[model samples]
Target: MDQRQDILAQWAADQIEQLYQHSIPAQMVTVSGDASFRRYFRIIYSENGVHKHWIAVDAPPEHENSRQFVDIANVWSNAGVKVPSVLAFDEAQGFMLLEDFGDVLLHPELTADAADGLYKSSIDSLIELQQIARTDNIPAYDRKLLDCEMALFSDWLCEKHLGLMLSCDEKLMLNQVFETLANSALAQPQVMVHRDYHSRNLMVCKANPPLHDKDFIGIIDFQDAVYGPLTYDLVSLLKDCYIQWPREQVLAWLAYFKAKSAQITDINEDQLVRDFDLMGMQRHLKAAGIFARLSIRDGKHGYLNDVPRTCEYIMQTARIYPEFAAFTEWLESVFLPALNKEKMA
Candidate 1:
């Protein structure tokens, strides 16, 4: 092993020994990682002639915050959300041991027949999660973060990746659009949001488990949870960046969530639908920017493949609202053709 891998292996061994009194084996397999700096590994062991596994996380303190992950895990788990249970943590070393939720991701497990039932389960848990109190202690998804996120579209995606040098008028137009989107977000009711509530982060647990409640769906990668706009998580789930659903189906789910959500919150159905659509536009813009940044800065070119789909969502949403007509024209005439040309080449 190289120097870094050698250190990680030793660290994993120590964590396994400390947590479960089990000796490390040579069969450590690397699991796929997400967009963040964290890395995951699966440790194989035998118990009663059957093989069992646990996940080991390598989140460098300099980059990722394992403490917040632990805190959020405890909070969400206590609040009846099916989040992974934290088993052990080494703060200084930036290592954590988490309960294995198995390999069945909600994305692949979802088919036309299963979508309704699975999404209903997810929305039910979301309602319960939004009702959790003590939200004041969690960091707010304030205007500053929102502005910074939108700026990435111009900074990394437009200027850096697409090589677009914006003229003065174009810059002003971008600012105006960003402001409008930001205001739409700020007008909504605030609730506890699992920032990345998409299909990939959700796991489909086995039917027989210690926790029956979690068997329907298991949530992970929630260290970035915040008290944010209520519509944010709903949009993230319905208009997922990693997957696409038909507009009719998405609308049905939106209506379903509105009914379930209003049972707990004071939002009206019409307003909730409006909030969900506008919030989805903002999220898609942010996602496209993030995907570009991931490719250019992190050398993760795989995300570039999803950029077109994300931009398509933005254009589609823009066409729906009369206020966004000009903005949609700019996107269609100026941005999308360029993106398509590049993709085709």
Candidate 2:
């Protein structure tokens, strides 16, 4: 077992003993994922003639954000989103005992046949998330936060990963693009945006059936929820980093989401399309930069393979906007070719 597995095993044992206060037989099984800072384990315990199992998330206070996870999980759960129920949490140790939602992620369900239905349902869940995000009670997804994330693209990916220094004009263009994207995003009606609403973060519960009031979509890794643009979560789902859907399917889902939004929020369809595309571009760029940084700085090379697709998303989106004509030209002539060469070599 690795260090993470060992820690999780110990945490599970401790939690069963300390928190549950049951001197019952307990077994711990580590779950699989590419998690960096946190570890997850399923704990099975038998007590008082009943058998129960729970997922124990061991975040190791120094390495992860357990508090945010607890807070945001509560918020989403209260909003009728299907997330794991929190059974118990220890903030100091960053250990959370949560309801086990089973381990079937949406990634394996993305075949050509099931793609349409899965995406349609996924969009419905996303719309529900947007409706909840629009509430003023949630925290703001302000300009500073958006700009800070955008800056990571410049500082880490452009300068550090690609070793390209932005000229004055290039910097101005970058700023203008991000400003337009951010303003458009911020101006949109706010909602509870799951900053990382992707396939991996979603779980399909087979063991425990969903409640009537709750959604079938079991959301996880949503600690970074923000109140921002309605299109942000939509883009995250449609332009997913792990799995790629065909353009036609992506458009169909987009149209479905637009109609849903119009019905709920009375937003214009064309503007929603523009916002989705622009937000996708911004997100793709950030994802590419983060992927590169993860490889170079964090010593995680698995993400490097996904950089090309992320860059492709940026290139594809840039082609649709006339305002980005110059940037698009530069991307095609300079960035795309260079990235391709790097990939091939």
lDDT tens digits, residue span 1-345, model 2: 666556656666776777667654445687754536776778887756967678877787887878878877777779877788887787887878888877788889778897788778888888777666454445678999888788777777777877777799888988988898888888777767888888888876664543434436678888777777777888888899888777777878988877766433566667778888888887887788888778887798889888887888888888888999988987877677767777777
Q: How high is each candidate's TM-score?
A: 0.94, 0.89
Per-model clash counts, in order, read 0, 4
- For residue 244, model 1's alpha carbon misses the true position, in angstroms, by 1.2
In TM-score terms, which candidate is top? 1
Worst ten-residue run, lDDT, model 1? 207-216
lDDT of 2 at 185: 81
| Cα-based lDDT for every prediction | 0.83, 0.77
Q: Give the CA lDDT, 0 to 100, for residue 120 in model 1.
A: 88
User: Could you tell me which 10 consecutive residues in candidate 2 have the lowest summed lDDT?
Assistant: 206-215
lDDT of 2: 0.77
Which runs in model 2 stand beyond 4 Å of their true positions? 1-11, 17-27, 33-36, 45-52, 133-138, 207-215, 262-265
